[model samples]
Target: MNEQPPGRRLGRGLAALIGDVNSPTPEPANQLAPDRTVPIELVSPNPRNPRRGFDEADLIDLAQSIQKHGVVQPVVVRPSPDQSGRYEIVAGERRWRAAQRAGLAELPVIVRDVDNRTALELAIIENVQRADLNPVEEARGYQQLIDEHGYSQADLGQVIGKSRSHVANTLRLLKLPDVVHDMLVSGTLSAGHARTLVTADNPAEVARRIAEDGLSVRQAEALAQTPAAERPSISRSAPAAKDADVLLLEKKLSDAIGMRVTIALKGNVGELKLVCRSLEPLDELCRRLGQG
Candidate 1:
């Protein structure tokens, strides 16, 4: 009588899916052997693959590796529903691209008969696990799954091995302007800095300053929090001077944790704050403090 949760419907987590794709050992008795060599021309990239850009240098490096050693891992594919004999790639497209550059006539493949939804899910899972998808691409992939397949944020977190908060935060990246999205795609701005700018009055201007001036994620957070009228045009503008010791300590703490650190002192009392761009650093900060 009760409704089942969507997260439970994600039959297996990323670990199991990854194992299915890249397990080094022989296939288990219960599972069908996905191993098969297919003509390179018969396999094509999925149009729906969430990853939009591949680094030329990284691909060339991979191609050189494939040329020397061959593709150790098989590319995952499924029979194209529209085309009679050709196959559509579900995962491992990067290796496929590299293999083409390596001039391989045939490729090793793991063929599965899955529908459109499962194909997208597999693609997203593989890319997300490998950290290959940029924040925008990653968020778009999540949105696609939700829009087309009725997946909840909790469902995505369960499938991808990320926290619900991580999923939520990543999705928020989509609300920024196109210029900000371009910054994310081009690697000019980090997800952390971009996250802080999402609610800024003029995210594009702040984002450009952050990139040009090389501000830390924490500094970007402070700038975003400040009203536009009060914010200095240049990041190097002078402000009320702090004690030399306090400035030194701030730099040291910021360097230690890779975030901005600030100290405020009042009559013999003080407050210390650490600015983190994302949950990962915050978790690390917590861990380090707990150990001490």
Candidate 2:
């Protein structure tokens, strides 16, 4: 009796959509047969690849690895639409670039016949799964799929293995100023810090404070709520004014729990008010506090 081939029955999902050839060692049952190998001169990077920037340091590291180990995983490619006898990368562009840096002459690739939509989806999925996209690039990729392909937020969540709320929140990052987006892309700001700034009245100012003061995400949340005029004054000549650290602490609690939090202290006897925006955030806050 003959045994069935591996990956031949991967029913109707991403693995089937793109060729199941991501593994370092291609199993005879799962690997793309014919084992297409293209010269480095014939392959071009996909213009629509969702990833915008590659860190030079990282590329050097990858190039060094490729030099030592050779490319273990084959890149996914399709015939170039514009040029004859040329291939466009559908996934693994980074590896391809590193191969060039390592002075490689050819690369192994899985040639898949795919249209524009499939190509875009494969690129996005591959980058996201590998955690290669920055927040801005990730949001832009999500927006492209939604706008061009008509994917709903819930549908996108399912595609990317995230929650609907998480998708919604990530989409909100696009509303921030270009500077803030740049900060996120360059790793000057954390995703948590960037998310809290989305709803801020003045995101640029908040971003500046975050970079300058090295404020924690929780502290940034408090800074967003405390009006600009009131913040610096907390340390000034107001004898009756509340302590600055106390205000920051209150804001941290509010941000951490996703609610409106206030603390009023009278000689160490204080009242705490945690205001919930809705039932869901409230439940989340309660759940988080319980975990704490």
Candidate 3:
């Protein structure tokens, strides 16, 4: 028999693995199935789970909902390899956390007999589908899968339902310094801003300036592209003061086009520049201008 390509082999069982985890609405039969309920203490989080940060406020809100209605969806788990009679959570860690907060003694779970690889895949799928993982977390997850399982970026894209470029761009975030990674995790910097800093001479310093000055992704990109020798002066010297009306117009234009806008005035003739971080936004701006 012929061997399947690496990407195809990696992507083979992803659809079935995602199954109900990707579903928005909970199936009635699966919810609170008596046989699926297990003691809360018996279920532990997967250490390899891609999602590291959980918003406390969001968790509190979920806990309140769980208290009112109980857990409507079952978390996915597998029999723990290290501990006998215990289950390791593959998905729904947030739900598990909220259930604990709601003082639940038992949790509904769908137990599957899966190996380490499949467990990680399920965790990533569930989090990515929900947009729960931050860029840093998502990138780290992809890196882990690649390092441990011989997965190519194309394989990851196919498995995660993302474009190959998207996977490649996300993986680029890992090249940033640890301080920059901290910024990303704390929401002090965005994926776009972080991406531009990947090849900068001093990413942490650039990231700090980007955050402190409230620079747009486009501005960050320009700053990252600037030479190290001139960066200090650029950081120190603020933009020329603008009239209130001009600033307001820039903001309006930025909001309207969903990109950064700058206006430079020289007498009656002036320049208005729209800064897009990616081709997609540029295309959208072109479409809008055409319609006008």
Candidate 4:
């Protein structure tokens, strides 16, 4: 058997929490005394969890340790009312899985009383606040807040105690290509590196370069500032603002049409555009032109 290296020795904190390492264990979420212990079966991994998967070798080592030590710590679980006779895991999936691999029939579990949304939000926030979440997971949380619960970016800031800009910035990471996202998750890239990428219309190409160049966050920011004359094909950009005459013509169109009209510049000459939503508005516009 390999001996524990000085730098890799089991920590006192882990020992104290689990009693021994072989047993299924739960890591403490909050400051508490006399940590409650229960079986691994009582807990479940989160469905919309951030962490993709644990390393197999590390897990195998953990399992071997479990065989020798038993779960030193307890796992946290909440009784499932919907699925009677089974409990949903609040946390400690790693220990639970390790115990299973170790062939432990039952692992220590601690029952918790967490509300659903509160539990989900807590799980997400736990990963996020630790900087453990990948960009994809972080974006999913921001989106969940916006789409599922109808919270605005400002509201998300209040809920998570983060700035709205932070929320927006994190959400922007979703725009990155899948390859870049994989890199971010695998620790080959950082979120700050990913942030600069989201602004690019062709983010995949930018992500590739960012990885290839081994660019620092500051360097990435500088790169992001560069004009896109030499980059790969991207969508046509928004048109530049129209000249004064075009703006005046838009105003004139609105006066003649009697509706909210926007005249956006097309090219050098620019162009006038008309918009009328309601039937009444359209009829009035026509009537004003003697074409009713």
Global Cα RMSD, each model: 9.1, 13.4, 9.1, 23.9
Model 1 residue 59 CA deviation in Å: 0.6
What does candidate 4's lDDT look like per residue over 230-249, in tens digits?
A: 54333333557666986787
What is the Cα-based TM-score of model 3? 0.74
lDDT of candidate 2 over 1-292, digit per residue (tens):
5522211222134565444433323345654443578898999999999998987866786787778777766788889989999999988898888889999999988787788877887788667756789999989998988898777887777666678998898899999999999899989998889988877889988898887777877788888777777765222223467789989998898778766788888895989987542223454554555667
Give lDDT: candidate 3, residue 250: 96
Candidate 2 lDDT trough over 10 residues, lowest sum = 3-12
TM-score of every candidate relative to the true structure: 0.74, 0.72, 0.74, 0.58
Q: List the residue pairs that clash in candidate 2.
A: none
Off by over 4 Å in 3: 1-23, 26-35, 232-292
Q: What do the candidate models score in CA lDDT, each in turn?
A: 0.81, 0.76, 0.80, 0.62
TM-score of 1: 0.74
Please estimate how well model 4 matches the true structure, expressed as its whole-model Cα lDDT.
Answer: 0.62
> Relative to the unseen true structure, what is the C-alpha lDDT of residue 220 in candidate 1, on a scale of 0 to 100?
95
What tens digits encode model 3's per-residue C-alpha lDDT throughout 60-82? 86787789878766787889999
